[model samples]
Target: MDPALLKAREAFKKKAFATPVIEAKRPVTSNQESGKESNKKPRKSAPAPVAEKTFDFKKYKPSSNANFACLAKIVKYMKQRYLDGDNEPLTLEDMLDETNQLDLAPRQRQWLATEALKNNPKVDITEDGQKYFYKPTFPLKDKKSLLRLLDKYDQRGQGGIPLEDIQESLPNADRCIKALGEAIIMLTRPTDKKKILYYNDRSIQFKVDDEFQKFWRTAAVDGLDDAKIEEYLEKHGITSMKDVGGKNSTPMQKRKKPTSKKPRNFKKHNEHMGDILQDYNG
Candidate 1:
């Protein structure tokens, strides 16, 4: 034990003593954390409300009465021109001038001229340069002659009259001819055969009656056999012959016939012969 103890003491003396070690120090807060907290993005603000634009239509309202009055005046002037035998077609400028002579206001004159051109085919506008001119479409002096010519064309059922002839007849012949065409189309349609036979937008359509319908069907079927006719009649519930004709009629009378009789058998000889034989045997 002494020897082992001495060896242990020697070994303990030769061993080096260890010093306590310290870890490298670091800051408590990280740059990344600081940056995240400091540089957080702000929320976006809501958009502002936009102002709405308003439109005013009152400034553009048109007067029906004024327009009609202007049109009437224009028609009167055109009628006069037609009577004067000025067959040259009138333009929008001519109409505006006429309206001015009538003492209409600037706006009123323009409105009237526009109305006249719109309602009458005898008025037209020409873009001669930067501005447009108004004039009659025919060679006639005025509206009355225009009306007469229109009536004549309508009665005659003619359309597309020559522009030169119209101009020669009325100064505003182009418009007149167009108006006449429109009038004829409106007044003489096929539907207006009753009360008024002619209108711009109507026509006369004749109604088909039962007889006509029957005729139509018969014509359509043409050359049908008895069986085919019977099938048609049965399918259509045409029970009686009169039903096919669409009316009732008298029953057909029976034809007279010659009378005939059966011939009688006159055979009494066999019975008499049997009686004679019986008597001979007895």
Candidate 2:
């Protein structure tokens, strides 16, 4: 072999024997570990799903023989079971079987479970980490009982019962409230804006002149506080129950006697001054 060929072969051998530049492989980690490694932030667990307060009935078509009013039948069955002291959570299959709805088609069954039964106002559904189950919303079955509850709350002077509570108790709460007409006063709470239902006593509901109502509504008391309003009313020969009871005096706070704090003996200089100077010098 030529000298040049020999030198080339030696160079090739040297190159082949040289240390291989292998890229360092990062150790594999789990999804949770990888998330922490990448962002240096602990992964936030998903928020638990909140239950819906209301269901839109318009989204579903009217119940017919097709679905066999599966939801209504189930509600009735559950309520009966509840009254009989059997308040155990019933499965969809169990509800369907009980309500003679096992013969429903797959799509219809799915609809009944996901939409109909779950959205029924009379049904109280819950999931126990394993499977979803159903129960009755409340023990009271009729609008009369709901009205009685409202009357009881009103009589007790506990402000007004929550509309959500009424809805949860009564199956046809909207219809019942509508049928009640002016017999119920529905007011929206200022804080959360949730509707509150107050029972109206027709015996005490005296008719007021339209002009007086207009005057009352047009009167702007927006900037006036209760005290200012009361003062103004008193000046005009109008006295409120609050004024008749007399004003309450503010309780005076007792002044604490000067605590004899031992006069912080003023040292002419800091005790550690020499030590501090020595440390700085060193």
Candidate 3:
């Protein structure tokens, strides 16, 4: 064999015998093991799921064939349910319980509210995101902002505010309520302890008495003016319409006017004819 061939063969044998070596890594220490575990972050235990409150259909389902007089009437009923001290949070299901459908889904309630109740002015049914709320009728268009001025124990559609308090909240609140008329009125509350101004006839005090109704009718007819309202209120002997029938008392009525007969046009017994003749001649 040639020298170059012999040299090549020797190189191939040496290259084949040569093996590559990899460096061995160091073993973890106790502290390093703890660090590893901490770094691994213990597969994050999944969060416990929250349970949703289920609606009670059998107990709370509305009347099947009942006909509400109007949307206002329906709102009135719903508001009374709240004010009656049964004041659970309202759901569209309760409002449309008139439909008699037990298996109403959330989306279905939304659709029903949008389609059936949204446009009606008699009642103020409102939706925020997916939640539905019953807003009271306000004379002003911004019901939400104006309503924020109120304090609610149960639900707040009706006004529990006093006249002076309301006046403080809104300068024209009286005029606004007057312009709104029966939409919001002064009435005894469900408790009947006080006469508070309410919006949309939401309280059980809705059953206005003869004198109470007469005052409002008279006020509306007399027109919306402080002077007229004061005079009319005074004429009715009504210091305050609040607690109108408290403790089984009759509602306030106007003070009776004194009666007296007018004098006759006939002449006096003596000298009347002669005096009249002389005066006519003069």
Specify the highest-TM-score model's number: 2
Model 3: per-residue Cα lDDT over 1-282, one tens digit each: 699999999999888789666899998899999888888855788989999989764455333333223344456565454333343344565655743454554544444466545655433443453323434343323334445444241254553666544543343455556665565547666664565765443555556589987887774554565556656777889767544434555879999886987786986666657656544464
Against the correct fold, how does model 1 do in TM-score? 0.25
Location of the lowest summed lDDT over 10 successive residues in candidate 1:
193-202
Q: Highest lDDT, which number?
A: 2
Q: Which portions of model 2 miss their true places by more than 4 Å?
A: 1-138, 161-165, 178-181, 187-196, 237-242, 245-282
Q: What is the lDDT of residue 199 in candidate 2?
A: 87
Candidate 1 residue-wise lDDT, 144-194, digit = tens: 675666556656886434434445446554565465565543232346342
lDDT for predicted candidate 3 compared with the true structure = 0.54
**lDDT tens digits, residue span 24-129, model 2:** 9897669868777888766799999998878555465545776756666777777656555466787888777887878766677677767776666666666552
| Predicted structure 3: clash tally | 2
**Candidate scoring better on TM-score of 1 and 3:** 1
- Candidate 1 positional error at 91, Å: 6.4
TM-score each candidate: 0.25, 0.38, 0.21
For each candidate, the alpha-carbon lDDT, in order, equals 0.57, 0.73, 0.54
Instruction: Give, for candidate 2, the lowest lDDT window spanning 10 residues.
Output: 129-138
